[model samples]
Target chain A: MNEALTLLSFGEHGWGDTIAIGALVTVSLALASLPFGLALGFLLALAKKSAEPSLKLAANIYTTIFRGLPELLTLFLVYFGVQIGFQKALKLIGIETYFEVNSFVAGMFALSFVFSSYASEAFLSAFRGIPQGQFEGGQALGLSRKQTMTFIILPQLVRLALPALGNLWLILLKETALVSTIGLADLMREAGIAARVTKEAFLFFGVACLIYLILAIISSTGLARLERWSKRGDTAR
Target chain B: MTVVSSDTALPPPPPLPRRWTKARILGHVLMALWIVSGASLLFYLVTNINSPFVQKYWPDYVDGFLVTLQIVSVSLLIGALLSLPIAAARASRWKVLSAPAYAYVYFFRGTPLLAQTFLVYYGAGGFRTELEAIGLWTFFREAWYCVIFTFSLNTSAYQAEILRGAILNVPKGQWEGAAALGLSQPVTFFKVILPQALMVALRPYGNEIILMIKGSAIASIVTVFDLMGETRRAYSRTYDFQAYIWAAVIYLMMVETLRRVWDRLEMRLTRHLKR
Candidate 1:
């Protein structure tokens, strides 16, 4: 029908523009959270490998608790939980302006926190696979511990971690859809509004699905290439 | 990056020159900061536990908790049951049997579950008048059915993958032995292959179930009065956003209990494999 076409058309009445922007937001947020997640994961891995018993226990608890909990619940805790914590802190400073946490920032932090827990384990496993002899060689050359970790251990770890890190990125990309519940103007949220407004729920939702599928396919292809590149040496035999 | 030789069975690195001196200090400092933050949050949560609003709304909170468990458990059971056949289908050598199941898994796994839920709930909602004309409107009319359907399908995709991986991990020699015994294909699958695959699949399936339990929170968006639904209601009405913290605690406890159950199941399944 004409109505369905109009509903889906890229014209002013259509949601084609809104949905495109929403998809971009989702991708950006996922990318923005990646480095943050990687840094946190690296620290957690380090903590777990630390000699201090307390530090190791804390790291274990962090990963266990976050990985075990649901992503939605974790989002609630981070979004609302962080707001409550910040407000309480503000109360101490005697400054209250009804300032609210930005949904995008809160959403990114929540996701990165969850992503880090999984990433740390992957990174740790990969780091462990690196020959300790490399570190020993670096140490014998009068290299500082930090230099050894950076120059010797990390390069090998990156090679091993690439495939896993790519997979985590894929998961993170999909997980970003959950943020729509908190009123972020991501693809899902935008589609939800358009569906409600036009009452052509199928039209808007189908578009959303297509957008997500496109994003997923593109990212997956890139990830597959990275995975293949990482495994190039193994294929020679 | 260089690929080291397999013969290089390297010894552990010597103690870092300064040992754990700076690193340990920095580690302690960083660890202490995180622990303090976590402890403070716990303290805040506990102190607010006795608020009058908590006492008044305790029943609603409990209702939400129960609803969460109900949705999660049902969807997981339904999903698991559905996935077993789909997984078997995926493992089938026949292209006719495998292709459709493979596509199903790919589509579901390729997209976010949240999008799938919306497409089903809202997209299906658009066909309401037509659906009502048929006998199936009764099922589609209820939010519960929509939530359960969406979740079951999503989890089925994941479960199928897990099952496929587990099936692949089964040794080829076992299948040969089953053939040597002159067992029929179905008998081999049910008796020999399934038993082994089930052992490997159980732990991952347990994790999936727990994930579903937590995922049920999303069902609230579609008017399902699950735990997250109830928590949202409590927060909006009383302006006590801290109610989410309580919900989080309940979810944490559920996950912890599931972890213990998963550990036990893993131990039980692998007992024979243990040296």
Candidate 2:
């Protein structure tokens, strides 16, 4: 027990600093991708809700492909595939320097795609929850299509989507661990290194699990509060 | 008189035309990003299908597919079996039984499966001495076995909750009806209640299986050569984006097939419930 404490202690000889940095990286990765994911997903919902068969088909195909594929598989594809694509394009342009995709950038890109695909479904459901009369109401009030979307539908859509989006955010947080496979110094990777160096595999991994559990707990509480706040103006239950 | 005259004059405007103008114009306006990316991706896929990619990596992918199928199926079977008792425990009135069951579910549901897998795979080394003493080291030592063990435990938590929910969804009248008819509790549960409960569980079970199929890709990180594993290997050798793309295609096909099959099964099972 004493030895375990020493190993995890925040000192030059301990791994506490490394693990703390990793936890920060994991949170930042999830944070950076959230806006991109939410925006893309809203667009997807719009596309699905549209009248054009071709546009709807495109949106359907995008969600099907991303949602079906494994998160790790998507990560590797984006990480390696982007680098390869860049290298080829650079070759074509005669800028012979080898190109690379940063692990953080690649991780964010892949997570955003996966998050958006899932979020699209949630957003679509939120759209369905709105009545047809609401759109007609917007029109009767002389609002343009865009104005109807922005001023009328958008606020309620955000409220309806909050729960599903919160769930997706948790999934995204867990998925950030996959970036560790590609050498992003996330919580999982740091734990892995600490385990290897100290030969205390159980201790570090257990610590990592605890950290994740705590984050999940906090997010659940935060989401509950946010949901309550969103419902403040809503009609009596 | 005008309303009736117009209603008679206009052969009910086709449902399509009314929605086409407004929504289509919005769709076109919102699809600027789609126009560029969608066209490029379609072009890339069309141009690359015949590029000697499948020919080279098809065998490896096939092997990986079989492995993937084996692990997922085996773990799911084991998980379903294990969930029965846990579900019972969770549904029990006793705190002794229910508390631990709830903890199991909470831990597995809250934490990432990747962390759980690593905990079992590498963390097994921490217990090397104790395991060897108990003649269980061999089981924990192999990545394949560790993965199966972790996945089974992880999925069992999810399955248990589903089972508990399904069983609870059966009305109180089910129990009372069985008692009034002089049927045994176990008999009533097995014969009268479970069938109805299964109907409730069917869709969630399908979703769970789909999740397992996707989650199984992490087995590759532990040196298990599942489909994603083979894709990584192929990509390492060729550095071709096509390798990962092919893997994605195969996975999507699997998911789509299962989705169709499950829908059919759900329809068949619930035919009596519908008109």
In order of appearance, the predictions have TM-scores of: 0.91, 0.91
DockQ of each two-chain model: 0.50, 0.58
Interface RMSD of each: 2.1, 2.4
Accuracy of chain B in candidate 2 (TM-score): 0.88
Q: Could you tell me the lDDT of residue B65 within candidate 1?
A: 80
- Whole-model lDDT per candidate: 0.85, 0.91
TM-score of candidate 2 relative to the true fold? 0.91
Give the alpha carbon lDDT tens digit for every residue of B230-275 in model 2. Answer: 9888888987788887788789889999999999999999999996
Single-chain TM-score of chain A, each candidate = 0.90, 0.96
Clashing pairs in 2: none
Off by over 4 Å in 2: A234-237, B1-56
What value does DockQ give for candidate 1? 0.50
